[model samples]
Target: MQGPLLLPGLCFLLSLFGAVTQKTKTSCAKCPANASCVNNTHCTCDHGYTSGSGQKLFTFPLETCNDTTSSKTTQGRKELQKIVDKFESFLTNQTLRSTEERQEISSTVTTILRDVESKVLETALKAPEQKVLKIQNGSLAIETRVITDNCSEERKTFNLNVQMNSMDIGCNDIIQGDTQGPSAIAFISYSSLGNIINATFFEEMDKKDQVYLNSQVVSAAIGPKRNVSLSKSVTLTFQHVKKEDPVLTIITYVGLSVSLLCLLLAALTFLLCKAIQNTSTSLHLHLSLCLFLAHLLFLVGIDRTEPKMLCSIIAGALHYLYLAAFTWMLLEGLHLFLTARNLTVVNYSSINRLMKWIMFPVGYGVPAVTVAISAASRPHLYGTADRCWLHLDQGFIWSFLGPVCAIFSVNLVLFILVFWILKRKLSSLNSEVSTIQNTRMLAFKATAQLFILGCTWCLGLLQVGPAAQVMAYLFAIINSLQGFFIFLVYCLLSQQVQKQYRKWFREIVKSKSESETYTLSSKMGPDSKPSEGDVFPGQVKIKY
Candidate 1:
């Protein structure tokens, strides 16, 4: 009886142990392909694979393992690789290469590069959270940077590298477009592209030794537009080619410096000569101040590219200062219109009071508001890599140009109205010779002022067509010498200012003569002062 009972118990124990081993095997058997069980407990996707559920280790039987690199970034790489392969095949295949002309080959390569850039930027934008994506193969390489933080102070620009080529671009260029949210830039480099579309494709490469394809053919672009032009110039640091002309820069500096000095003198004249310190002179004074500050800041800090935030601040300041100048020009127009309207009135108090009330707010507040709106909307567009000025991207320059054009138009209309009013006033008051002469003088000064303050800026807009080069030079010279024009028109031309200048000059000469006489008397010693001619006025001669 004992032997039979022991045998049954042993068989039962064996059956129970076998059931436990079967359960452990079943647990691991449920894991999908590209995944394995860990310690017979949980499932983990293999290297280069990810679980559909996004977990490293998962026990759910429904979870599937997928290729981790097959996401958007991989898709981008594959697209770029496909383009490279197709181009390579086209280049290598004798049948294809033999039929294509040199121009055709160049065109085909250009199309490929543009396509690669567009595809890479599009892919990077699709996954902006990635921030950066780099893909490399034997024939091609690409690197992308996504700027989604609204270009904070710490990240105002970006530098990207592919192969041995690199690009430096401002964040604003990438972020400025119709689309909102994140922006991305892609740099694609082709290892074999330079060989086919090398220096030969460049029409400017006339000299063999002077120019050659020193680096791999690289393409850069920003999404979603992928425009060939950028608001800021992208600095492409090729391995062996580089260049800049400083002649224009030097001209600009010297011209602006002279204008700045003239502006200072004109401002001093306007402030000190109480005779010319009326509403019109005040307008000239403010305009001179604005131009003075703008030119001074530009001379000092326009090229200061480091500490990007400071550059941006300088740019904002320039924008405001220039806008303020134009605003004052508008005020001048209004004042001229009011003065012309009230030319026959005895008490010009109302016009003066009206001007005093509105000039300050309109001159300064309007620009401040304009800058604030622009900055709040797109602050990144304020500064660029090369200069601290308004950017040309997305019609951003219009912030300055728009106000300028409007002011110019209004000034022009006011000018016409002023002349109209002056014409009637002069016609009716023909017998009053003094009034007619004063009105004619006023008309002449208005014409000159209008030309200096409003019309010269039109040259900037005319910087296109056949006359672009000429217009550019004219714009530079006339606009840079704006301070000189102001001083010339307002101070040197005004009879009152001339009289004051002459009086000041005479006083200076007299003071110098008196100073010399005192020096001579001192040198001659106390006992040697015998000449009565040496006694200057306002000095009491002591009698012993």
Candidate 2:
């Protein structure tokens, strides 16, 4: 799996097999008794390539496949017949005459589509798997699979697979799914005719499928031979392969559902649950809210093409929102340090929600706005599906690099102050010094997470080399699981938040118990306090 040898090797083998292994035009060795090579290339059947009459291509295509003056081999004709029958059955099946039938057909088609696409995925999963495949024909894909396919289960899908040497196929482009699993399925069926191979995931029983054959270019390919690699466009139907694991999508579900619900809960907690609204808890709650809302909108509405155009808009916006909220959380940590620095009285006049909100906009928002404007003006500069990231235009160096510089600068300043202050305090006091050390360490961890996130953005610039891919996945997985880290640092691991949460839980339980004790299910009396079940304020119990 040395880097230099992989792609070139694949290209050579593919080109070799495709260019040389090609059969010489002659009387097909597999052609029937009546079959004749009138054109010196194609082995014409008594009928044609169509069903019921045309002899198959067992040796119908290449001249080398011909056996002049001899009858077609039985095996060759039967194999050809099999291919014809599969296509013919689609044209004639009467079971698919209704809307319900089409849905059923789509399901069956997916099963078959998954088989082929999975081959590509499975092959890719192996050690030193092919990351990209370039087809000289219609740039088709082979290793794609279905992900998040919980529409229904217990249904089996029917699949068909083919391997061809050459075909009359031309493709514009091909792409992988945005996520690990396949997002769509297509049944693009086509014949090689004279010099190419065409493939479809499903054949439309009728016009209802409205299966339009569209394509794009990608740097990858899947084939009959594992070793042969070619940059030919092999017509492909971007098949949707189903994903089977529930555990993998737990976070997706959390972000899309539970995390979103947490946004509302956090907001309500702030408004009604008074204890959750202090400086530290409030900041954490607010950060959680922004993340929840942004993802909710992103997951639900970012799929349509015209609206999909909002991918950049959404990506840019979410980037800011995500970063801004995270920044705010960082800022909150800074504020705590400032208070410890004896600067607590600097802004005790009144709580400035507006100022805090401004931090989020400035933190994630400014960068988002900057990147969006940069990408819109020079979109090609934006990374496509391969890099699978937000791309910036000419000034991206500024938009991206600028933020990193600022964030890192701020972190440096904080750490310096912390170092100086902690050093001075450690000499006189051990208990206080230990507390400062742990607090500083938590801030360091948060800062490191941000640094990593920033690095993810920077890595987009070098999407060409092998290291870039490793870093890309690192960025993707880390960013994807950031919430867990935040939870660990702010809630689970932070004893401060743990104490607050325990106190809040007890209050909720106590309030619920009080309600039941008094039989006060309905708030008929004005003096009645809203039950903890109705409100979600995080209060520092200060139990002592």
- How do all models score by TM-score? 0.58, 0.40
Pull out the clashing pairs in model 1.
none
Backbone clash count for every predicted candidate, in the order shown: 0, 63
Candidate number with greatest TM-score? 1
Query: Whole-model lDDT for model 2 versus the true structure?
Result: 0.45
Please, what are the lDDT tens digits per residue for candidate 1 over residues 1-544?
Answer: 8999999999999999888767655778689999988988788998657898899987777799997544866776677678778877865676655578777877877787777777787778767767889876546777889887777764366888765478988887777755577788888777656645553365456566555466667777777765555777778876532122266566678889999999999999989999878888888889999999999999999889666699899999999999999999999889888888888787888998999999999999999999999999988777754568876545789999999999999999999999999889877934377778779878987898798888789998997778977777787778888888888888888898899989999999999899977876776688875465455454555444
User: How does residue 218 of candidate 1 score in lDDT?
Assistant: 79
- For candidate 2, the 10 contiguous residues with the lowest summed lDDT are 190-199
TM-score, structure 1 vs. true: 0.58
- Write candidate 2's Cα lDDT for 1-544 as tens digits: 6888898998999988776445544334545554555545555544312312334433434222233212222333344344444534543454543334545655654454444343443333331212322211112322222223322333323232322211222121121212233232222222211111112333533567644333231222322222233234354333221122355345445535644554555455455545445665666666776676666655664443232345545555555565566466456546544544542234643344544655555655665676667666665333322222343222444554565556656755665676566556545554554566655664565455455334444554454566855555554455554455555555455455467678889999999888664554343255656544453233222221
What lDDT does the true structure give each of the candidates?
0.80, 0.45
**Candidate 1: stretches off by over 4 Å:** 1-247, 429-431, 525-544
